[model samples]
Target: MRSWCVLVPTAEGELVRRFLRDRGLLQKHLAIQREADRLVIPTVSRVEIGLPAEEREFDEAFAPIRSYRDVIRIPDRVRPLLPTSFDVIGDIAVLKIPDELAEWRDEIGRAILAWNTKLRVVAQDHGVAGEHRIRRIEVIAGEDRTTTVHVEFGLRYQVDVARAYFSPRLGTERMRVAERVRPGETVADPFAGVGPYAILIGRRRRPRRVIASDANPVAVEFLRANVAANRADLVDPREGDAREVLGEIRPVDRVILDLPHSAMDFLPEAVAALAPEGFVHVYGILEAADRTATTVEIQRIVEGEGRRLRHLLVRNVRSYSPTQHHVAFDLRVGRA
Candidate 1:
């Protein structure tokens, strides 16, 4: 059957195979195919393997049964609750375990580490909390550390998941915003977390300057280090509440409001910091049933701020929960 495969030169096939296996990315059920000078190896996921490999799909035969669940040794009744997927951030695997499976968390973590050889830590995530929006993660297996270097689009970010909020799932959304940034434009990220959006924009776009601020001091520390590592010299990292920090900065051509929980609360501050005819990318969690109502509410807020809503584009980024969605509102505003 056809499946996702990585094509690599015959000389580097063994090395790449080891790398993939170590990362728990190699599909154990499929057989690797040799094609003259190149070898086709199947993978469990489609991602950059940091090797000279080309992603392709081809017909391949299945091997013997080898799944993480097969060795889990759990009761048949609770087997269905076994997580099939988790978030992989660099060398760490984060799992959101159900409350019922708390007793088997250590075994689950071990199974995950066995399934993926490259992971050094396995953490059970209890979601974000507190004023800093930090994740409540506990080490269930392997090393006990929340710090790791995550690579996205060739940029390295030293992230501490326990101290700050960083979502690997937002890679596409960050790129979308970065690509829209025009040259010579000044950008501002009020809730910049580890400089994901800011560094990407600074390196990819020829913006005049990017002022990235966050209320969390640890996030700012990592953001500054990431800016230097990524050579995004144009990004100015600031540590303070965004409402106060934005007031100190000059008017920006684009403002990014990433605090989804209460981004709308700061729409007035965002509008105030924006230059005339500027853009604002605001993210929020809204009920999926009534998207139109959210748009109307945004229109009401923008007009109330004495600004003309020249343009507004609403995009559903992803499903935040069963009933709510993570939404992005792209707005272009000017003096009324």
Candidate 2:
């Protein structure tokens, strides 16, 4: 069937498209078609009579609806509150819906399914809670299972989101740390969860040995499974407190502490476990304004252990919240 659309010169297509999209006038399900020197974009409303010169009314004939916005059927008043994106792990879709849109969770899940037929589950995130830092998720659609194997950088990780802590967002950060690892050097990930960091380092850098430890037994189980799945033989999966684990495997060439909220509490153990001239990759959550103070504090911690910081590099891994960031400090320490 034919429908009303906005026609614009090909040169001004993107501008007009953006204008329509910003105003929620663009019909996402219909594919943009081109004829002669003009582009035809379908719209839900035919109220473009007073629009700018680039956009003019036209009849769009026989264009199939390939994709549509998730909130197409939702009331205009509530559409703006919907989240535009979500995280996907394996066949599961994890969404962080706002409280205002809580009632439409099922509709949102169905919309996600419409966007990707491969996704088998849609789970709502209630944030990470408790000492394990496990995500509290409520399955709103599809399968009820929470366990899945996520593949990143050609490595596979088996994680149960409800039982273990894992973030697909950290894939690049994991690779960055792995790239810094040198072959023939032993590495330790004291707070390793599901072996994402340790397995990646072992598989990519081929380190001499990687000791991966996690206090959460469920995480340790998945870590061991991931090691076997990825055939990361160099990683030794251990289940225990990071401080105790590091104390047992002391003097490693590199140590990775990824517990952002409380990684500093284990700094003493990290310093004690570092071999001479070894590096420690410490992850923390800090405000942008407090970066300098945090760096100084870390330096003081190292110095308190009678060790000198030979070289230190800090980077903003990601934003933890509007006011805070997930930061990493790569420090090369040695005897004072």
Candidate 3:
């Protein structure tokens, strides 16, 4: 049958498939056809996923419905409220069920599992909490365990979703920062969650060392395991408060601050650890209307610590809310 398909190279099949699957765009009923070095993946919706779609012939397979909405036994009036997509962390699916759909969570969970054969667990995320920034997840269907291994850019990371925070959404952003590291330069990631940024930078670039620190012991434990799993010898995992950890490892050539909500609060610690003309990659959640003032305040923060902002680049990473954005500030600072 002729269907909308994304022709992805064999090397990039897994990445693109996961991307399409997470967004509920992948058509699961059709058998993907292999042509030369590319795999043609069928998609249900026309989403701009940086790849062009073309009509291709796929073997029609007797498979279950591809979307949870298709199998969910809910009334037509409340069908619109069913979540269209969920986060897939490894084989685990993290979904947020609204109060209106709370009664049918089990049915929804089962439906979601049926949609994806690779998913071994389906968890309900009740928001992140506490100093460690852990998600309060409850297993709705499949396996009861929260531990899983997530892969990004061909590197493996052991992640306990309930005990630690790891956002697969930042995979591209992590690689972006990693590609910026200069050889022989020491990088410090103060808010390293499971060593994503630090390990990525260590593997991608020949940094002298990548110091990864986190207050959460579970996250740091996984970071250590991930560093070893990937054989990222340059990445050193440390368990402690970022301020204290940064103090112990002084004079870093670059620093990564990933705590979006409270990253600015630790700006002084990051500045204190930087070498002359050192770089700092800080993330924050900023109001769209206050972008100008926020940039000015960032400059002020850098200057307040007796360091002049030699160069600054602002990037809006993603949308946090209707009026707020997750932003990144790339800063190079020198002596005042």
Candidate 4:
């Protein structure tokens, strides 16, 4: 049984693997082969593999596979009900399975494990709830574990998925906010869950100080662990309500409010904690068509705090639901 493959120089094997993984084109069942200093990588399709400058296809006689869909081995009856995608965090794969697929949860979990050898746990997201916005997940395959060490942007974060709210999807956003921090500036990440924002800022930007706080004690514990794991010497992890913590850390150069659902409720405290002409990054969940209303509400909140919004940059971070969006507003505020 021969299979088609993409040929490239052995030196470019890692690059090709990353490219395939990023594009979701990697063929997990076919093992990579070596021939005369070149690597042959099995791919899902032969058309437009998006080869880099250093890679090229090698001519070989092989039978082409039917489709990548066959690799998962889902029954035709249940195939349409399968989730299109899932999140891989460290050694765990978190899936969002619909109730219709409830009977095949275990099968779906096992298939996810087979899809990625690095994954040791397969969990299904039951949705986020409560004040901390923590997700409830059920382990359907492999080891029953919720704690995992995830690495992003050269920083390591230990997260207990059940106890803390952490999302790998926000990795880029974290770096984006960190890159905006100027050296020697004091930052306040009032809702710094697991220290993603605080640790990234302290490690990459080397901010003078980062006051990271969370209301959930379990999350705070992970935050402290992550701070030390990443050797973020400038980060100060605290366990308390964000409003109270911000009050104690008044006059910070930058303030990050990441409690998307309730961040607006703490606008006054964030404004009070900001230094003169400071920058504030606020994340909120809003209806897709309510961008104007969100802006007006934020502007009103700042004005009520006796601050004028000097500059405002609004961005849609991601889609929270079919009708809602995860939006971010970067506001540069000063005395009115």
The most accurate candidate by lDDT is: 3
Worst 10 residues of 3 by lDDT: 63-72
The predicted structure with the larger TM-score, 2 or 4, is: 2
Could you estimate the TM-score for every candidate? 0.80, 0.84, 0.80, 0.80
lDDT of 3: 0.89
- The positional error of residue 1 in candidate 1, measured at the CA in angstroms, is 28
Model 1 bad stretches (over 4 Å): 1-67
The 0-to-1 C-alpha lDDT of every candidate, in the order given, reads 0.88, 0.85, 0.89, 0.84
The numbered model that scores best in TM-score is 2
Q: Compose the digit string of candidate 3's lDDT tens values, residues 165-229.
A: 99888898998889999999999998898998998888889999999989988888889999999
The reply for model 4, stretches above 4 Å from the true place, is 1-69
Q: For model 1, how does the per-residue alpha-carbon lDDT over 223-304 read when each residue is reduced to its tens digit?
A: 9999999999999999999899878885889999999999988888888888878999998998976678878877898888
Model 4 TM-score relative to the real fold? 0.80
Residue-level lDDT tens digits of model 2 in 190-237:
889999899989888869999999999999999999999999999999
RMSD in angstroms between candidate 1 and the native structure over all alpha carbons? 11.9
